[model samples]
Target: MKTIIKAPPRRKPQSAGATTNRPGNPATGKRLPYGLADCVIFLAIAIPLLIAMCATGRPGA
Candidate 1:
């Protein structure tokens, strides 16, 4: 009988304070603004919360 073992995947090491997902990629010093998709998503979630707050006593009410 034989058993097979799998090794865990390896990950690249990132320096502390990694800002890969920030408004700008600090690591590469590149400016990247939010795309239209990001804006749409923000609005999709924000609008519902705003509407719920305005029409009700409070959130989860």
Candidate 2:
């Protein structure tokens, strides 16, 4: 009976702050003005939907 040894797959080397290290990447670390603009736009759409749903909701249904 011959035993086969399977070696573990090698992993690629990652930099010290490659992933989720926001401070290392300024572009990803800080929120842009456009992000706030997008939030405002999303809120504008969401609030109206919420109000409409509330106003039209049936008591039992």
Candidate 3:
């Protein structure tokens, strides 16, 4: 009674002409501008929420 263990298959190499489907790695154009815009929008929404939370929690509103 011997158990035969099977090995997992290896991944295939990408072709030179194959397009990358991953984010933040566009084949053409820049990805940094969009990233910065996202950061700015996030901070804009977060700052007000934090300030409101602090204001409401204060003893003297």
Candidate 4:
């Protein structure tokens, strides 16, 4: 029989000089810049695949 071990949940440490209620920190609130960059990168890869799929639809046109 094997025993299962569970890890403890991680907690975020509060900044010394920063306010915990501020909107800049991603761990505490929304991160627009990072989210936008991620979306752009995803679209960059997806667009090429979409174009390739469309181009191949004409049976080697």
Listed per model in order, the count of residue pairs whose N, CA or C atoms clash below 3 Å is: 0, 0, 0, 0
TM-score of each: 0.40, 0.44, 0.40, 0.38
Q: Which ten residues in a row have the lowest lDDT in candidate 4?
A: 17-26
* Full-model lDDT for every candidate: 0.82, 0.85, 0.84, 0.82
lDDT (Cα, tens digit) per residue for candidate 1, span 1-61: 8998989999989888784656454557655588889999999999999988798866676
On lDDT, the leading prediction is: 2
The TM-score ranking, best first, is 2, 1, 3, 4
By lDDT, rank the candidates, best first. 2, 3, 4, 1
1-61, model 4: which lDDT tens digit per residue?
9999989988898788775555665577545567878899999999999999998798757
Model 1 stretches astray by more than 4 angstroms? 1-32, 58-61
Looking at model 3, the pairs that clash are none
Candidate 4 segments exceeding 4 Å error? 1-34, 59-61
Which digits, one per residue and each the tens of the lDDT, describe model 2 over residues 1-61?
A: 9999999999999887786644755676566667878999999999999999999999888
lDDT of 3 by residue, 1-61 (tens): 9999999999898897896667765656755556878999999999999999988895865
TM-score of 1: 0.40
